[model samples]
Target chain A: MTTAGQAPGQAQANLIAIPRDWAYDFLLFTHRNPKPCPVLDVLDAGETVSALKQDADVRTHAPRYRIWENGELKAEPENATDYWRDDLVTFLIGCSFTFETALTNAGVPLRHVDQGKNVSMYVTDIQCRPAGRLHGPMVVSMRWIPESLVDMAHKVTALMPSVHGAPVGAGDPRMLGIEDIDAPDFGDAVEHEPGDVPVFWACGVTPQAVLMKSRPPFAITHAPGQMFVTDMPDFAYRVG
Target chain B: MTTAGQAPGQAQANLIAIPRDWAYDFLLFTHRNPKPCPVLDVLDAGETVSALKQDADVRTHAPRYRIWENGELKAEPENATDYWRDDLVTFLIGCSFTFETALTNAGVPLRHVDQGKNVSMYVTDIQCRPAGRLHGPMVVSMRWIPESLVDMAHKVTALMPSVHGAPVGAGDPRMLGIEDIDAPDFGDAVEHEPGDVPVFWACGVTPQAVLMKSRPPFAITHAPGQMFVTDMPDFAYRVG
Candidate 1:
């Protein structure tokens, strides 16, 4: 099931597990490109438990996992325990659910959620600030909001910069290099009704897309729309 | 010269250069302890020119440099070119000046800047989140603000989370392990007059202190009261 709008107040996270040797650069990559990678927690090498939540084992906590070998998709496993290695470091990145909850609470209706479809994600031409060994374009998630409530939506998400922050663009898809609004790079596209303005936010899928380009010898990430919910309050990420 | 009042609009940074071997761990330490180490610019190994500023060299842009070997102070030089190495990775962290300028611009009078003294800083008992090979207690810089204006100071600084953010504590230094308010571990002590409240902020000196404890074989840092000013506008850090 899609994780968006699930566990209202609890924060959900995007998962990225890489070899310990590549953990440092990945951490740097997150810091340098914070809009796309708000770090929730970084489990040390070989750690399976999350410090942010009680009794949550990353190896089997998530509903699904995507394993990669040298930039090639290898398997979509029900659990990552079989793929878990002592030399792996797992990174929990802030997911959009935290902000979607905030948006829903603020009276901003999301078309994707209403249409029962996963949020559309696109790989933009915007290049992320490259770290030592990783470099790739940014990926963004799209939500159709009423034109009248665009400012309100921006204000709400701006308060929670940890969850992809505010919309990167509001009215135009071409500016971000997305040719067709209906053709998303990831997830299913939803219906766009009248007076709806397409809003784009930095997506946690960015690092995953980068991993595909940089070709890390081995890596694992959460399957699309499948997330790990943490006990930490969503308001804990509020900056304003 | 002190950097607190200088560079009214531009941002200032705390410098930390270490062997490339320790750069990854040090980068993680900064990310985990962002309040005390809000990263501004991290120069890749062997890079002397700052990506944030024009024609500024880390080796000579700052007025003074403190060289450390095995956790002990080895030398204080006017320039670091002699000590520079290809394997050295330099990290420029956010300095309090950016926020202090915002505080001043917001009409919050600072006693340290008014009295022409270096801001008093103390080592707190609060431990930083350990990352890889580095961990230590948090250090705090104290600013005495008028009792009624403390809220204004907080509101102003809270907008600049990238530069040490809001105050960690407002009153009672003893709670932070500072027994003698007049005897500061770093910088000069300032007089606390009537209607003044002591506000403490996470300081940039924290990583330097941690270096002393973790004992990295070689490191270089900016001398106290000396800092590098970057061309990046201070308002770029505002969250609201």
Candidate 2:
């Protein structure tokens, strides 16, 4: 979620769930395509407890909820009290917002934050390693990094592998089958300075893309930039 | 599996299978516990083909195999042809040997290789992020590195996240609940020099540990030091 204007410990709860039978398949899909679907936490079927946060409720904490049926968005409800099912399983996926603080702290500028727009995203020709009835091309978010600071940005983000670590590709949009950088599939495109390079990182939107393509019977996900806030610090995701 | 003394492209294929219904759960388990269970490739139910290699069969390639039933060792068959089932699914998990070559090339010596013994491993008090019916304390392998080269060893292994990534803990065995470094739970313990620091990494033995603890109805894994070799190179696991 966009951590741009939010305080460090602000409330940004968002929740998603799927049928219990499909829960294992969904977890497998995320595992097979980890960069784009890093799992932060998972709740067993019919469970309301949040391992990442103490005494947190998934059904009502999120400021907003989206209902999806057969790959179509059907409602934007204030809470999922009526939709809650005993057979539903919840998963807390890592979001790019988890690394934004580290990136900014390391002196890497973010164009989306500066311009007040969602990060530009594109669908790539790269097919994700498929797992059981789920397969689709990867989706990546683009950022313009000063050529000199690219390595610093990479290092800063690489520290947190849980949140789509490092740039998948940099300096060329064509390599990812993006024909026009200005015309992104999702989010708004921002301009790059003369010395800036187009850098791309795997986006969480990739799972949404797979859902749209595979058309699972039922599913739910956080709205773009609307993530569930966890008590875990960004540093917790870093590796030695 | 140990890469020492084995021919580079030799037949080291080992196979394991579980019920078709548990396939997604098994895959999800590996995905949830990636460091110790790096999945190299997976075969669809009833299929003998490997996406990572051409003309490879999971049932017969490895020099050895071990069978487990309801969490207990049942057999050590040379091949699984007699046990093959149409409903079985095969997965090729990433082995630490994938990163051993790089570690050596970076000038870090491996004690297990020098002593011709399996690397030392221990079951830590750290519980892994669980998936479905699988949950257990994390298991790790121990290696002694020259104090000055610990950073280099970390960076070398960090590049390959698929193969357990960097050391989870180093220099302090007590932090991981290891009462005595010399008394490891698995593999052979090696002596450490005065200036050598003990580095611990997520081990493939972790899934086995989970299997033993959770008592899954049925499960199979490569024997320690006996892994499924793939056509993919070690470099393939590296990231920027």
Candidate 3:
């Protein structure tokens, strides 16, 4: 049996099974805010989804759920056993938290996370290498780093190849093909002190635009700002 | 107007454009000793194959050429202009010199190069990831290194992804699924000093075996110990 839950600024607790439609909206919201809402897993239909933690019931895991029909929000369901379906595919996309954690551990400061603001995201002209039905321009989350540590920053982040390694471009925002730095495609802007260059990493929000463009007949994801935590520790990724 | 000429550490004095029938034996000799004979380019019948070096004249550019016919060495021609054909395909493969240069730059000492002996190569049970019409067990060149710095060595070399990055395995020889390390399938075995571990990198010989297996209608490659030295620097592959 599998259980799912979400916690703000912490690990998720409790588990719940919700309607297919609710799963879709929850995933959409999470897609909209991926950094805080990292998706861990989605259960296949006819499969008994249980948390690896093995305590929480997914039947009523998260405190809330939202249902969407034809791209419109339909209902707020506390529990959704009736809405379960025979065919549902789950996804586990990486979150920015992994890299953010890495950056902080390396002593690089992040203003957005410090100020309780969303990391600014920009859709660049650079096209992502597409896979299967998924196709979209890469969306990048920005952070400012001291000029002295720019090279160190690159070396540190490049090690995390799985979760968007290294910045697409540094020094000039225009080189990334972004028109304006202040007016970003998404999220709130932050202060960039002098001698600071903006660094960018591929954002997890990519799948949202991809899904909207791809428009699969059915989908389910975690709600925005609510993420599914997993058993994987960040330390496992470090290469010797 | 890039012309093939004498590359460093190459025993061949000049690049020779030989007739297809005459080049077979030289190609066979190259297959016999692949570490020293990294194939860079092959031009057939002159349909403008451009992957190896820019605008190479298979004939005239190479100072000497050998012509092979039906598993027999027949002629050594200065140029095979009259023997050129449109049916031949060129193969540009990685050279050991590239990886050796990379290792030296990263401070990983090479015993064979330092001792002026051929690097020891072993045939391993590990198989090369096959491509179209190519298949063979991987041949790896061994370099002795300090056991403590093994991790750093893997990291530094792994960055050179195009030129066989990282060791497939380290420490025990049998652990790599190889029964014997002392008696290599090819090349001279070197002495392993105390506190040294044997490190292995994929050798270019893989394609030759693959070619023999595929038995392409016709192919051309650089002679043993002869490589097509390019103007491109080693660092071009480090990042991207």
Write the residue-wise lDDT of candidate 1 on A68-159 in tens digits.
99888899997988988899898999888788878888999978778878889999999999997898999999999899999999899887
* Candidate 3 chain B minimal-lDDT segment of 10 residues: B1-10
Candidate 2: C-alpha RMSD after superposition = 3.6
Which model is ahead, 1 or 2, in terms of lDDT?
1
Interface RMSD for candidate 1 relative to the native interface: 1.5
Q: Give the CA lDDT, 0 to 100, for residue A108 in model 3.
A: 82
Q: lDDT for each of the candidates?
A: 0.87, 0.75, 0.51
Docking class of 2: acceptable
lDDT tens digits, residue span A73-127, model 2: 7776767777778888887777676777777888988888888776788999999
Q: Model 1: runs farther than 4 Å from truth? A: none
Ranking by lDDT: 1, 2, 3
lDDT of 3 by residue, A33-121 (tens): 32222344444434445433345434344444444443334555555445555544333455554556666677787777676666677
Worst 10 residues of 1 chain B by lDDT: B1-10
The TM-score leader among the candidates is: 1
lDDT of 3 by residue, B1-240 (tens): 111122432222113333334333333333333332333333342444333445665444444444444323455455555656664433345545565665666677766656665566676776654322334566676778888777777887666543455666787888656677777654556777789998877765454444444554444433333344555565653542
TM-score of every candidate: 0.97, 0.85, 0.52
Model 1 DockQ, alpha carbons vs. true complex: 0.54
Q: Provide per-model DockQ scores.
A: 0.54, 0.33, 0.04
Off by over 4 Å in 2: A1-16, A147-152, A171-183, A189-197, B1-16, B124-130, B147-152, B169-185, B189-198
